[model samples]
Target: MIDFYKYQGTGNDFILIDNSKDDFKANKVDYAIKWCDRKFGIGADGLIFIEPSTKGDFLMDFYNPDGSQSFCGNGSRCSVAFAKFLGIIKDQTNFEAIDGMHQAVISDKHVKIEMQQYGAIESIGNDHFIDTGSPHYVAYRNGVNENIVEYGKSIRYSDRFKTKGTNVNLIAEKGDRNIEIWTYERGVEAETLACGTGATACGISFAQKHNIDKGIIEVKAQGGHLRIHLEASKNDKVYQNIWLEGPAEFVFKGVIEDEN
Candidate 1:
């Protein structure tokens, strides 16, 4: 049996496990696939393991529903909240993830996380590609309809990204500093409620296109709202000091009765 806590940030849900003691030994990928199943298991977009860290407060081990390892923005925020629940940190904490070190602050009802600096961006046709902690493809459109899943899938599994796959974000500008995004995550392979890294990547992509490098942008996802703060990097196309702020709520806690 495994004790787990479920949490969600902007509707991006995760199954969090405290493996700091190194006693919970289970095949990670297998468990991720099983527990992330909505009908068969715990039902989450991903799984996060809180383990001991040498470089920071703790180590965030994140896995997708398909059992692939990836850096998740909302999952990272949920990890921060989980750390607080475990009495590991107070108001603020720093943790190491697959992407590297990240800092987060716990607020009244939200958690703000600092994303890594990205310096590489390529414009492929009308779309933009950027790795905001996670590889993402940002495409602009007028309205986000139901066909986004099919459109995003075509691009996500296209020859350009077929081998590795990439998250696809369909974005539409609402107004100055406001944008709406719908993401088809790679591992999830479906349209999720929201994606932190996808929103962050969208903010940077929009900034580069319009020449607005530094500022806060409001990103509306299907789940809820998120705020992304970006600072101009030394390079013309790079962005730094990117912060993702949103609400992460505790859903429930339980022990898995069956492990078979």
Candidate 2:
């Protein structure tokens, strides 16, 4: 049997395994597919292994349900919370993810992680594309409707991104420093309740368009609320000091029979 803990951040859930001892040796891709199946196993958007890290507090090895790898924002936050639960760190921590190094802080259930600096946003036709750890295609709409899955698939599988695929986000400006967002994750191939990188991308896109120098952008996702703090350069293009903050909560824990 394999012990695991389940965690969620704004409804983007994950199955977390403590591999710091390096005892689990099953194929990750195969297990990620098997364990993430809703009907067959512990359902989750992804799977993460907390491995020992020489460079930082821990190493976040994350994989999407489909076995694809990427730098996940909410997954990273959950990893931080899990690290604390395991008595790895206190309030602050620096960790290594697939993207590189990241710094995070935990206060109760709320976790905030610092994102890497991003360059100018790329305009594709009328939409926008930005890589906030994960590549996202942001479309500004009057309102986020139910057609997100269909519309998102059209863009995600387009010639430009079909090779590797990209996360699609439909966003609508709510008011000053606030926006509503819906995300279609590439690996899941469906609309998730929330997406961390997608929310960050929408916030940055809104900031660049509105020429906001520095402030917090409130994002309302289908699952919950997230706050994005950013500081834009004088040109209103380059962005730095970006932080993604939201609630990372423990859902449950159990042991699963090793199918491998």
Candidate 3:
């Protein structure tokens, strides 16, 4: 049996296993695809392995339900919280993900992570595309009845992004500093309650479109609220010192029989 902890940031849930001792022997990709099944297995948006890191406090190895790998922001937050639960770090930590090293701080259930700096935002008609560890296409919408999954799939599977695919975000501006967002993740291939990288990309796009160089954008998603802080330089062409803050909660812990 393998011990696991379940966690969620906003509503993007994950199964976490502490593999620092190198005890997990199953093929990670196969295990993620099998265990992340909603109807047949533990059911989660993704799976994460917390392993020993030579560069930071720990390494976050994240895999989507489809067995695709990426640097997940929400999963990183949950990983930080899980690390705290395991007494690996106190209050703050520097962890490594697929993107690179990241710094994070935890206060209660609220966790804040420093995101990587992005160089530019690609314009796609009225929409925007940016990479915040994960690639995202942000489309602005104003209160309309539409099937998000269908619309999102159109863009995610479009010829431009069909090869590797990109996450899609449907966003509506609420105010200068607030916005509502919905995300369709590529790897999960569905609309999730929230996506941290998508939220960050939308926040940055909003800032660029509104001519706001530095500020916090309150992002309201289907799952919960997140705050994105952005600082831009060189006439808002490069964004740096971005931070994503939100609640990461521990749901439960259990043991699973290693079927592999």
Candidate 4:
């Protein structure tokens, strides 16, 4: 039996396994697909293994709900919690991701993740294009009808976003300093309450388009509220310290025998 812990950041949940011994690396895809099943299994956005590493604090091996390899922002937040739970690292740690090395700090109520900024900013009509670990196309306007389940997925899986697949978001400018966003994730292929990387990408797009100089922005998602801090350089290089601040709790801890 493999022991695991479950954690969620703004509704993007994950099943965490302490594969610190490196004995559980095999059969990752099949394990993720089965363990992440909604009805028959624990139901999660992905499965993460905190593998023991000599290079970084720990290596987070993340798998999407469909058993595909995908980098996740919110899932990384949970990875921080899992690492802390297992006493693998201190309150702060360095992590290795598919995109690059990442730094995450665990606070009392939230996890602060230091991520790479937008690589490219393009305009697709009113939408904005950016890559925050993962590629995202941001479309922000007023009166989106709030039926994000249909609306977000249409873009999330549309040809433009489909070939490689992209996460879609609809943002409503609630206040000058506040924004409300609804997200449709690619791997999950559904409108989840919140998306960490999506929030960061959208926030950067909004800041750039508006030519605003604010560093802190409050982002409200369908699941919860989080804050983003933006830092940009004179040469137009964007750097960000985004905090997906919310309650992350240990929902359950148990073990399951490998069926395969």
In model 3, which residue pairs have backbone atoms overlapping below 3 Å? none
Which candidate order results from sorting by lDDT in descending order? 2, 3, 1, 4
Q: Return whichever of 1 and 4 wins on TM-score.
A: 1
lDDT of 2: 0.92
List residue ranges in candidate 2 displaced over 4 A: none
The candidate with the higher TM-score, 2 or 4, is 2
Model 2 TM-score (2 dp): 0.97
Report the number of clashing residue pairs per model. Answer: 0, 0, 0, 0
Ordered list by TM-score, greatest first:
3, 2, 1, 4
- The worst-scoring run of ten residues by lDDT in candidate 3 lies at 231-240
Tens-digit lDDT track of model 3 for 1-260:
89999999999999999998877889999989988999999999999999999999999999999999998989999999999988889999999999999999999899999997455898889999999999999999978355779988999889999999999999988977899998999989999999999999989998889888888999998999999998887856568889999999999999888763
lDDT of 4 by residue, 43-84 (tens): 888899888766689888899888877677888888888888
Q: What TM value does model 3 have?
A: 0.98
Q: CA lDDT of each candidate?
A: 0.91, 0.92, 0.92, 0.79
State the lDDT of candidate 2 residue by residue for 226-256, as single tens digits.
9999998765667889999999999999998
